[model samples]
Each structure stands twice: as structure tokens, then as C-alpha cells.
Target chain A: MKLKVYTDRMSQPSRAVIIFCKVNGIQFDEILISLAKRQQLAPEFKDINPLGKVPAIVDGRLKLFESHAILIYLSSAFPSVADHWYPNDLSKRAKIHSVLDWHHTNLRPGAAGYVLNSVLAPSLGLPLDPQAASKADKLLTKSLSTLETFWLKGNAKFLLGSNQPSIADLSLVCELTQLQLLDEKDRVRLLSPHKKVEQWIENTRKATMPHFDEVHEILFKAKQRFEKQREMGTVPKPGFQSKM
Target chain B: MKLKVYTDRMSQPSRAVIIFCKVNGIQFDEILISLAKRQQLAPEFKDINPLGKVPAIVDGRLKLFESHAILIYLSSAFPSVADHWYPNDLSKRAKIHSVLDWHHTNLRPGAAGYVLNSVLAPSLGLPLDPQAASKADKLLTKSLSTLETFWLKGNAKFLLGSNQPSIADLSLVCELTQLQLLDEKDRVRLLSPHKKVEQWIENTRKATMPHFDEVHEILFKAKQRFEKQREMGTVPKPGFQSKM
Candidate 1:
């Protein structure tokens, strides 16, 4: 049996897994667990990941969740994958692990919280917590600054100065891509200050290419839907009840 | 030159790294960065880890942060250490990675949040957000349930059924060990119902042995300090400002 991946592109991690599999030409079956529809909360999905989050995989007898771990596992399990994705060199691998471990508490939360508060919550009919959104924006800005000053210090296009994009780049770039869902003003305000980050995002996009574009289609569609809703004056009320 | 570890045992991750080094007999210089003194915020420490987090390492030319990444680096860097700590087998390694990855969003936050909110905040003379504490407790309980029902199934002595404690076990067991700072009533409430989890904690402690007890001395001291304060009827006032 082929490896099975459970995901929903709306999730940044899920898109990261999808792109990793596609770019590496790893054989896998993709199963959607839509968060917008609350499909992830289902019993069957919970069996695969008790936490009910996405980007989980089943390869042979090994069942795994967490995109970073899955990325590492896939790279190792399929030796055919280019080593640049997750290098075997001890220091380089540890650096990648450092980037990933730092990501959860740093970039992921910063970017995700900002996007969710500024864009997704409003579209999903949830009250936009202004205080929370501001805090998230601060975190997002700080994270971008760190990315520019620390990780992208040299002329390297990817994180950790890697010439080729690693899973860290994929995971992080996918996270920032959620900014596309925000309005032009909010997006620009949140992202425009960091020229290096913008360049890095484009670099990551170019490296990943058509697969990156393909995996992110759901986000594109969501942006369109939100825009259409705004034009139609169909603004969702605060406390409007629908599962996110 | 020996590996230099910058840590403060008050931090859970710091203790994990300290214990891992002690148990595995990895040589290192221990530099204390007291979170209680805001020493992590110092310029020199920031040079080591811009994020200003504890449990960073300087080994040869490699500079790494985040305890999980540091643990991986140490295990790989010191090949003489036991293999069961981080097996070379593909599936076993992936399973360990899975547990580590799952840990960040689930167990670490839950246990850490509960300790911080219910115990640390009050002890530090900060307001205990009851609502946040309750939510964290729920997450902690749910995490323990998942650990018992899923990860700890069978007669396994450690996570992933390994007879020897993996780095994942060490990292997780250290996170929960923070519960020691809580009052006996609160600690019992948070831990008593989960029998398997309690056993797993004991199992992990036994596997890690004297090092575990030795590394945890600071937490025990903090508990004693709190108890002393309680006995003197000199509880610190809410909104009291002190570094932590």
C-alpha cells in the first residue's frame, strides 16, 4: 500500500506536507480533513491523530503526525529524496532541527495567530479580538525581524543559509502565505517592512515552483470568497455561529 | 574544549538537557542563566540564542538552541551514548520524532501552562488567572488521557515501547515534573486520576536514575521555598513585580 497523508490545504502544515511529497515525488494518497468544515474533529480522523490536527501520515507500519517529524521521516524513509531537503550532515541536520523546534513557539504561532485574528476569524463569523490581533501582529513582526537578522543573515535564499529549500523553509513559507488571505492594507502593514522576508518568500516559492502554487489553491479560493463577501456587503456578524 | 551548556534548572527544558548530559556522560560546561534574574535577557546570552531561551549549547563550531534539537544534536554528536536513546532504525527514530513533535503542541504547553498559571504565577506574586488555569488543567488532563490510552499501551516501560528511556521521555517527564511546585491539593487534583501517567513518570525517573533526582534539585528547592512562605503566613502580594 502507498503511504497515506491526511491533510487540508487551509492548514499551513498540511500544505507543507503536500508540497514536500509532491516536490520529492514521494508516492502517497492525500486525504482531506477540512478544518473549516470541522472534519478534523471527527472520530475517524481522531484515530489517526488523537490531537485531531493535520499533516499526519501512515507509511508502511509507521504512523506519524507533526509536519516536521513527517518531513524528517519521509526524507529518511525514502532515500531517493534529495539530501538537501533534510541533510545527513550532523550539524546541518541539527540546524534544521533547531529551526523547526524554534518554529512552533516562534514563527508558527506568530504568523498563524496574526492571520487567524486579522482574516480567518472575521470570515469565519467569529468576533475579531482587536487586542489579540494586535498582540499577534507584534509577535509576527518580531519573528520576521529575527528571520531577517539571524536566519537570513548571509546572501542565502533559504533559512540556515541552505542553497536549497529545506522542510523548515517549506513549513515557514507556507505559514507566511496565509497573509494572502488578509486585505491589501492589513497584509502590507504586516509584511511590507521586511524586504528580506519578501525576497525569501519569493525564493522559497521559486524553489518549490508549480507544486507550491498547486497546494496553496485553497487559500487563494478563500481569499476570493472573502473578497466577494466584502463586495456583496455580506459581512458576518460577531458571534455568528458556524464551525471554523 | 568541552560542550558548553547555558541553562537555569528552574526552566524545565534546561533541567532535561542537564539530566541528558549527566545520564549519557556527555561532558559540558554549565552556565547558569537565571530566568528569575532576567539573565536570559542579557546581551551576551542573546548572542548565543537571539530568542533568549534557556537550554542552548555550544559544541565545537555548532551553536544550537531548543532542548529537543539540542538533545538530537548531543545524541548524534556523541556516538558512544546508548543507541536506544535515539535509535538508528528508521521507524523507531520516526516514532521518537513523532512523540517529540506531538509533545510541543500537546503535553508541553498543557503541563507548563498548568504549572505557570496555577503554581508559578501565584508563587511569583502574580495574579493567578483562574480561567486560564482551568483551561490549562483541562488540556493537561486530556493530554494525560491520550498518553495513557494510546502512547503508553502494552507493557512498555517508556514511550514508543522502548525499554530504555528515549530523549522524548526525558523531555516530557521533565515538563511534568514542574507539577511539583504546585500545592499538594492542586498537584494531587491534577495528577492523581492518571494512574498510568504516574507510573510512566516513575518509570522515566527510574530509567534516568540518580541524574534525574540530581538535576531536579532546584524544583524541589522552589517547592520548599513556597512551603516556607506559606508557613510564615507571609504570602507575596498580587501585582508584586519581580523578574521571572
Candidate 2:
């Protein structure tokens, strides 16, 4: 039986998992759990993931959530997955793990928090809080600088100065894509200062081609749709709220 | 040369790393980084972990941070460390990783947030906000309840229904120790409902033994000190802030 991947394209980590599977040639069925529709909360989905979040998987009888765990499992469990993604060498793998863990508390919050408070709030039927958005932007900016100043300080093309893209690269770069949802001015203000981060995102994109863009198509489209809605004056469905 | 572990006992993750090494018999020198003294911000420490967080390690030239990453690295790199702490089996390791990642956004924030905004703020030279503390309490309540209803629902003695404890157990149980700082009323109010969670904490503690109590000595002492000060009309040093 093929691995069953339950995900929503709107979720950043969800996108990373799908792309990882595609780029590495892991066969799986994509079961879209709509975040906007509140499908993740359905009782049936709960059995698949008790936490009721996306980017979960069902491998035979085993159930799992948290994209990092799923990604790590896939890399280790699948023989076809390339070694560079999560190297077998102890120290190298540990450094990648460091970046993945760091992404959860640092980059994930900054990027996800800002977008949720600003752009996605209305669509999710929540009020937009400029003050909260501003706070998130500060965090987002600091996280971006950290990625630029330290993680990318070396000549390597990706985070932790790795010449090849690892799961960390996939996860972090997917997180940065959330910025595309922000208004042109706010997005530029938050990210333009970090030149290396810009290049790294592109490098990661180039490394995991076609699949990266293919999986992200929904996200880019949403950005365009939200832009159009804003031009006409507004958009916020607000039927529910999710962590994102 | 000894593996250099830079940490502050006041920090939960720091204690977890130190205990893991002691429990697994990985010999190392403990270099205390004083959170109260703002020593984590020192230039010297930044070289060890650019994030300037406690529970970082320098294993020769490899500088690593984030307790989850450190724990995984230690288990994999150290020859004497037992497999149960981080089993070599792929499925088992992935499940543990899921819980570790889950802790960051869920339990870590709930436990640490409540303590910082309520009990530890004054000692750390910050103001306490009852409202923020209340919010954190709700999240903490929910997290603990989840721990009871799901992670420990099976017959196994520890989380993931395993007879043996993994690093996730160590990391999460240390997070719960922060709740000890709460006043008796608040502490009981928050933890009383979750009978399973309470028992699970004990199970993890017993699994690690002498080291668990040995390492948590500082935290338990702070609790007593805070209680005495409160009885005499209060405590809040307002020195500086750390994540805890």
C-alpha cells in the first residue's frame, strides 16, 4: 500500500512534506485536509491525527503528525531518499536537526504569525490586529536576519551552510513563502534587507524544481486572489480560526 | 578534552540535556551560563550558540543548540548511550520526534509562559501580568489534559505507550517542573484534573533516577524560596529575562 499523506497546501509544513516526497520519488496519495473548510477538525480526521492538524501520514497501521517527524521518517524509512537530505553521518544530521527544531520556534512563528494576523485573518473569519502584525513583523525580521547573518554567513548555498539542500532547507524555505501573501510594501519591508536569504530561497527552489513550484501553486494563487480582493476593498471569510 | 555543555539550571531544557548525559553516562564538563546575570548574552557564549540560548554544547568543534537536537545528537553520537533513549528503529524514532516538535508550540509555551508571566517574572526582573498568566494557564490545562487522554492512554508506562522513556519524555517532564514554581492554589488548580499526567511525570522521573532529582534541585529550591518570599509579602528580582 502507498503511504497516505493527509495535508493542506495552505499549510507551510504541509507543503514541505509534499515537496520532499515528490523530489525524493516517494510514492504517496495526497489527501487534502482543507484548513479553510475546517475539515481537519472532523471526527474521522481525528483518528488519523488526534491533534487535528495537517501534514499527518498513515504508513500501514502507524499514524503520525508534525511535518518534521514525517519528513525525518520518510528520509530514513525510504531507501530511495537521497542521503544528503538527512545524512546518516551523526554530526551532519544533528546540525540539520538543529535547524529544523530552530525553525519551529523561530522562523515558523515569525512567518506564520505575521501572515495569520495580517493577510489570512479575514479569509479565516478573524479580525486583523495591526499591533499584533507589527509585533510579528519584528520577530519575522529578526528571524530573517539570523538566517542571513549566521545560518547563511558561510559560502554554502543553504542554511547551516550546506552546499546541498536538506530537509531543513525545504522546511525553512517553505516558511519564507508565506511572505508572498503579505502586501507588496509589508512583504518587501520584512524581507528585502536579507539579500542572502533571498538567494537561498531561490537556490532551494531551483534545487527542488518543478515540484516546489507545483506544490506551491495553490499558495501563489491565493496570494493573487487576496490581492484582487484587497484591490476591490476587502476579504475575510472568518468562519473559523486555526494555528496555521 | 571533555564535551563542553553550556547551560543554566534555571532553564528547563538545560536541565534535560545535563540529565540525559548523566543518565546515559556521557562524561562532560558542565559550564554554567547564568540566565539571571544576563551571561547568555555575553559575546563568548554567542560563539557557542548564535541564538544565545542555554543547553548548547560544544562537542569538539561542533557547536550545537536546541535541547531536542542535542538529545538526538547525543544518543546517536555517544557510544555508551542506550538505544531506548532514542531507539535505532526508524518508526520509533519518528514518533519520538513528533512529540518533541509538538512540545515547542504546545507544552513549552504553555508551561514556560505561565511561569514567566506569573511566578518567575519578578525574580527575573520583569513585571507579572495576571491576565497573561491566566491565558497561559488555559493552554497549560489543555496540554496536560492531552497528555493524559492521548499520549498515556495506552498500557505502556510512559509516553508513546513505551515501557522505556525516550528523550521526549525527559524534555517534556522537565517542562512540567516549571509548574512547581506556581503557588499551591494555582499549581493544584492547573494540575489536579490530569491524574494521568501527574503519574506520567513520576514515571519519567523514576526512569531517570538520582539524576532527575539531582538536576532539578535548583528548580525545586527556587520554588521554596519563592514561597517563603511570598508569605513574607513577595518576590520578583526583576534582574533580566530568559526563555526558561
Candidate 3:
């Protein structure tokens, strides 16, 4: 009954969970479930997470899904490392939770959905619906602007007001890294236009995930596979048309 | 120097904070900010929450916004009660957090948004667009089905696996109460269609807010006022069709 994590390395959520375990010294087992191969839909993993989503965990008798929830659980279980990552100071912790909550509803959906549908899917040889991609791009831009203005502006190294990395930075970095698989143009847009964010991302890479190259490479390969699938007409392009 | 919550009693988020405090026995002074009067936009209040959203709290010198964030903060601050509401159990708590997180993105936006635009605004003599209302209705229905199949099937009383109430129930109950502001027929549709959910709602109301009569009356009055406004041509009907 060892602590086990079920994940695909390329998924942003899975990457965040891996980093959380690494930073906190949580030694467990890894069960790789490849989404590209539709391994998540397998019956065995379905019992652990009925929704069939990844980055789920089995810690002894405990089984949990959702990366943010898993992060909170790990922090509480391992309080020795919680001060820097989760923070006991109520306000600081609240700030992190606030950002995480908003990120799930706003940034995560917009960034991942838009990039996948518009840039990545098109590159995969699927039909590219420019309008949908543009709408998603706008949402991502708005989310980034809000993050910059409200949370990340004066912070030194992390998204939270911390010199050391927090779970907020971990989650965000994983997501931003996943975005690189979309298109080179989006990569530049995310990294260049927001200079502070770009620098902060590099900071996170050094502090938390020095071996991020491997993860990025996996995601890059995923992009190539998606493109091949589209070229083979295995998947239909997203239906997106301007209503206006 | 004491805990202070800036809220409008009429707001859904504010009610969440208030209910959280009430359930957990965390006493705090409340600073009522009338949203209808645009009091939250006042520069002084904006200093506390730049988002200008109510249910913002100040504990000592630390200020925080977002109702779910505030709930997490309180749980961290008062660890003695964490097991009771937030729960330290990894898998159980993850289930609760997932439900709460999903509620914000799905239920709160569509269900509560519809109440505000269709019923409340119209009661205030503001125009209500049939198209927007239809979209909200569909979104809410879809959300309710998810809740039924995924969340509330075997719970009996509370959300998670808990026999007693928890933060999961608090977050969801507050959102569910927003539906009461809808027209009577809509309320029935929102409530009666789901048996377990309806029972859970009733149990929560009995356990937490006993005098549902008063709250229901206030909501009814608000809806009436909105309808009067609509009749008086004070606000235009929803101009854009919802894409939900």
C-alpha cells in the first residue's frame, strides 16, 4: 500500500502533482496512464476516479483526484514543508488559494482549451477554426493580464508573495510549459509579452523543476502525434464559427 | 484588530462567508456593503478587494477575497475545526474540494447568473431576455444532472461521505439558495426534480438556516422589485444571447 500517483507526464495537472511530490519529499510509486492511447478510459483507473481524469492518487487507503485538491491534501499531511509551499499565515495562504481557484475556472480552461483547439489541433492537420481559437486566445490574454496586475506584479520570484516557490508557481509553470506544445507563436506570446511572467517561469524551472526538459519533450512529442492523427483524419476539427 | 467581513447580505458569495462563519462558530464583525447602491465600488472598499467583490474579510491586518478562499483560510487558521468541516481525510476532503471547485465554475455562474438577470432584475423593473433565460436554464439543468449522478446520489444528508455538514454542503447550499430567487415554477423545477438533492437542501436548511420563511420572503421581494424596474423601463432586457 505505497503512495501511488496515476499520471501522464505531459499533462499540466500531472506535472504539478509530480512536482509537489518531488518538492515535499513524498516518496511513492508512479502509475503512468497515457491519455493519447486512451488508457485513462480503462476500467481499472475508472474505479479510482469515476470521471476518468488523470493525476489521481492512491495513498494507502486514500484515493484522490484533482491536482489542487491533491496539493492541499499533501500539504496538510506533510506540514514540515507546508510553511513555504502552502503557508500557515492565513492571508498568504488565502492569496494562493484564491489564485488557484481562479486559475482553474479562468486561466486553465482558457489557456489549455484555446491552445489545444486552435494552434495544436490545426497543427495536427485537423481543421483549424480561427474564430474559436481567437476567442480562446482573448480569454487567455485577459487571464494573463489579470494575473499580472492583481497577483504577480510585485512578487519577487513566485506568483504568491514568496521568495521561494509555492504550489501556485508549480501549477502555473506546468500549465505554461504545456502551452509551449501549442505553437511556437503562442509560446513566444506567453513568454515575451509578459516579461515578468517569463522571468518568473524561468525562476520556477530552476528552483523546482530543473529536469523540465524531459517533460517539455514529452509534450512536444504529443503535439506531433496529434498532428499525425489529424493528417490521418482520425479526429474531426472543432466546429467554430463566428456568431456575430 | 478583530476579524471583519465586508459583505452584502443579498449577495451569494457574502452569504457563503456568513454561513461558513455561522457553521464553524467563527465569530466576526460584519461590515455591510450595499451592492445595489454600488457601495462596494467605493475607493476605500476597493482598497480591501480590488475586484470589488463582497464577502471580503479582514482578520487583523490581513485582507482576503473570494468566498472559497476565505473558507480555506478559516480552516487553516482554526485547525481544531478543520476535521469537522474541511476534513483532513485525504480522499474525502478531495471529493469535497472538487465539488466546491466545480460549483464555482458551473453552478454559481449559470444558476445564480440566471437568477440575477432574469428574475431579480425583472423584479426591479429591468428587462429580462427570454433567450438568456433559456441558456441559463439549460446550463443549470446540466449542472444539476452532474450533481445528481456525481455528487449527491448516496449522501443522504451531507455532500461528501460525512453524516454531518461540511464546507462542501455550505458552498453548495449557498448556491442552491440563489435558485429560490427564481419564479415559483422555476424553483420547483430546480428543487423537486432531484430527490436526493432536494432532501439534502431541506436538511441543510433545517440544520443551518431554520427560518427559511424570512430569507425566502426577502428574495421574493427582491424579485418583485426587479420586475417593477423592468416594467418601469429602468434597464434594458439582456441584449446578448447567452452562449452557455
Candidate 4:
């Protein structure tokens, strides 16, 4: 039996998982768990991930959740994946681990929180709170500044100054693509100060070509829908906020 | 030079790192960066961790931060450290990874947030907000419920139903220790329903022994300070809440 991945492209980490498999030529069946409809809250998906969140995988009897962990497992379990994704060298791998762990608290929350509040909130069952959006926006900008001045210093193409993109690169870049859902003006305001960060995002996207684009296509489509809603001045129905 | 660990005992993850080193007999010099004093944000400390958080390690030339990443690196670097700490088996390690990753967004925030807002806020800088405390309290209960119903099911000694405590167990148990700062009533409210969670905390503590008790002494002392302040109707001075 092939590896099975349960995900939703509309989610950033889910896109990372699918793109990882495609990039590594790993065979896996993609199982969609629709977040928009709250299908992930169903009993069936909960069995795979007791937390009922996306980007879970089943390899034989082993069921795993958490995209960073899934990405780590894939890099190790699949012998064909290049070492650059998660190197065997002790110090190098530690640096990558540092980046991955850092992402959870810093990048993931900032990017996801900003998008959820400002753009994706309505469709995803949340009220449009400018206060909340502003808070998340500040975090997003701070995170970008850290990446530009600290992590992506000098001419480094990826985090930790590695030329070969690691899982950290893939996961983080996919996270930034959520900015595509933000209005162009908001996006520019958030990203304009970080030239190095901008370059790194493009580098990561370019490194993981067609597959990266393929997985993000759904997000692109949703962006269109969001734009139409904004132009039409329609509001998403109230209640049912995903506190997840 | 021995491994150098930069930490403050008051922080949850920092204690975990110190305890892990003590348990594994990984000799290290402890450098305390007082969070209460706002020393972590200083330029010197920022050189070690740009994110400016504690539980960072410098093993020779390699500098690593993020407690989870540091734990992962230590387990892998020290051959004497038993495999049970991290495990070489792919699936077992993956399951542990799941718990660790899940922790950052769930248990850490729930536990840390509750302690911060309800108890530690005044001394730490920010004025207490019952509303934010209520929000964090909700997440604390929900996360505890998940642990009780899902992760701690059956007669398991640790998460993933393992007898041996892994890095995830250490990281999470340390997180729970912050609840010690809560008043007796609040602590009971948060943890009483989860009998298994309480037991698991004991199991993790017992498994690690002297080190665990030794490291937690500082938090215990701080707890005393908090109690004294409460009895006197005094408040922690304002002007320095750690956003970290």
C-alpha cells in the first residue's frame, strides 16, 4: 500500500505535504479533508489525527499529524529524498531543526493568524476584527524582519544560508503564499521592508516548481472568490468560528 | 569547553533543557539569562538566538535554539543518551514528533498563557486582563481534555502509549509545571478532570528524578514569592512583560 496523506490545499501545511511528496517522487494518495465545511471535525478524520487538524499521513499502521513532523518523517523514511531536505550531518540538521521549530511559534502563527483575521476569517467562520488583524499583522511584519536581517542574512537563498532548500524552506514559503489572499496593498505593506525575505520566498518557490504552483492553485482560486466578495461588499455568515 | 546552555529556570522550556542535560549526564555550563530582567533581548544574547528566547545551546561551533530543537539535537548528539529519549525507530520517533509539534500551539500556549495572565502578569510587566485569562483558560481545559481522552488513553505511562518518556514527554510535562504558579483552585479546575494527565506528569517527573526536582526548585521558590504577594495584597511591579 502506498503512503496516504489527508489534507486540504486551502491550508498551507497541507500544500507543503503534497508538494514534498511530488518533489521527492514519493507515491501517496491524497485524501482531502475540507476545512471550509469543517469535514476535518468528522469522526473519520479524527481517527487519523485525534486533534482533527490537517496534513496527517498513514504509512501502514503508523498515523502521524503535524506537518513539520510529517515532513521530517518523509525526509527520513524515503531513502530517495536528497539529504539537503534534512541532512544527516549533526550540526546542519540541528540548524534545520531550529528553523522548523522556530516556524511553529513565529512564522506559522504570524502568517496564518494574519490571513485568517484579515482575509480568510469570513469564509472560515470568523468575524472580521481589525484589532485582531492588526495584531497578527504586526507579528507577520516582525517575523519577516527577523527572517531578512537574521536568518536570511547576506546572499543566502534559503534559511540557515543553505543553497539547497530544506523542508523548512518549503514549509515557510508555502506559509507566505497565504499573503496572496491579502489585498495587494496590504501585502505590499507587510512585505515591502524585507527584500531578502522576498528573494528567499521566490527562491523557495522556484526551487520547487510546477508542484508548488499545482498545490497552491486552489488557494489562488479562493483568492479570486475572496476578491469578488470584497468587491461585492458581501459578508460571510456569522457564528461557527474555527477556534482550531 | 563543555556544552553551554543559556536559560532561565522560570521559563518552562529552559528547565526542560537543564533537566535533560542533567538526566543524560551531558556536562554543560549553565548560563542564566533572566527573563524577569529582560536580559534575553540584549544584543549579546541575541547573538546566540536571534529569536531572543531561552533554552539555547552552544555545542562547540553549532548554536541552536528552540527547546524542542535543542532537545532533539542533544538526544542525537550524545550517544550515551539512551535511544528511548528520542528513539532510532522511525515510526516511534515520528509519533513523538507529532506530540512535540502539537505542543507548541496547544499545550505550551494554554499552560503558559494561563499562568502568565492569571498569576505571573503583574510581576512580569503587563496588567492582568481577565478576558485574555479567560480565553487562555478555555484553551487550557480543551487541551487537557484532548490529552485525557486521546493521548493518555489506557494504561500508558507516557504519550504515544510508551513506557519510556521521550523528548515530547519531557517538554510537555515541563509545560504543565507552570500550572504550579496558578492558585490551588485554578490549578484544580484546569487539571482535576484529567486524572491521566496528572499521573503522566508524575510519571515523567519520577522517571527523570533528582534533575527534575532540582530544576523545578526555582519555580517552586517563585511560587512562594507569588503566594507571599497574594497574601500581602501586593502586586508585581509593571513595565516589562516578556512578549516571548
Question: What is residue B75's positional error in candidate 2, in angstroms?
Answer: 0.6
Give the per-residue lDDT of model 2 (tens digit) for A116-221.
9877887888898766666677788899999999888688898777889999999999999988887776677777898999999999999999999999999999
Q: What DockQ do you compute for every candidate structure?
A: 0.74, 0.84, 0.53, 0.78
Better of 2 and 4 by DockQ: 2
Query: Tens digit of lDDT per residue, candidate 3, span B1-244?
Result: 6689998878876776776776567878889888788888999998898877788998887788888888878886864554767766666767787777678667877787677666666444567666657767778887877777777757557776567877777778777777755555557766677877788877777767643434345555766765566568764433323332
Taking the tens digit of each residue's C-alpha lDDT, what string does model 1 give over B1-244? 8999999998999999999999988988999998878888999999898879898999988889999999998998897679999999988998898888878877887888877775577555578666666667788988988888888878888887777888999999999999887766667777788787899999999988899999899889988887677567564332221212
TM-score, every prediction: 0.92, 0.95, 0.84, 0.95
Q: Count the backbone clashes (under 3 Å) in each candidate.
A: 0, 10, 16, 0
After superposing candidate 4 on the true structure, give the runs of residues whose Cα lies further than 4 Å from its correct spot: A235-244, B235-244
Q: Over the stretch B65-102, how does candidate 2's per-residue lDDT look in tens digits?
A: 98999999999889999889999988888899999998
lDDT of predicted model 2: 0.87
Q: Model 1 segments beyond 4 Å from truth?
A: A122-127, A235-244, B122-127, B233-244
The candidates, ranked best first by TM-score, are 2, 4, 1, 3
What range of 10 consecutive residues in model 4 chain B has the weakest lDDT sum?
Answer: B235-244
Model 4: lDDT of residue B40: 96
Stretch of 10 with least lDDT, candidate 3 chain B: B235-244
Question: Model 3 Cα displacement at A202 (Å)?
Answer: 1.1
The per-prediction CA RMSD against the true structure, in angstroms, equals: 4.2, 4.2, 4.6, 4.3
Best-fitting candidate, scored by lDDT: 2
Q: Please say which candidate is ahead in DockQ: 1 or 3.
A: 1
The local distance difference test score of each candidate is 0.84, 0.87, 0.73, 0.86
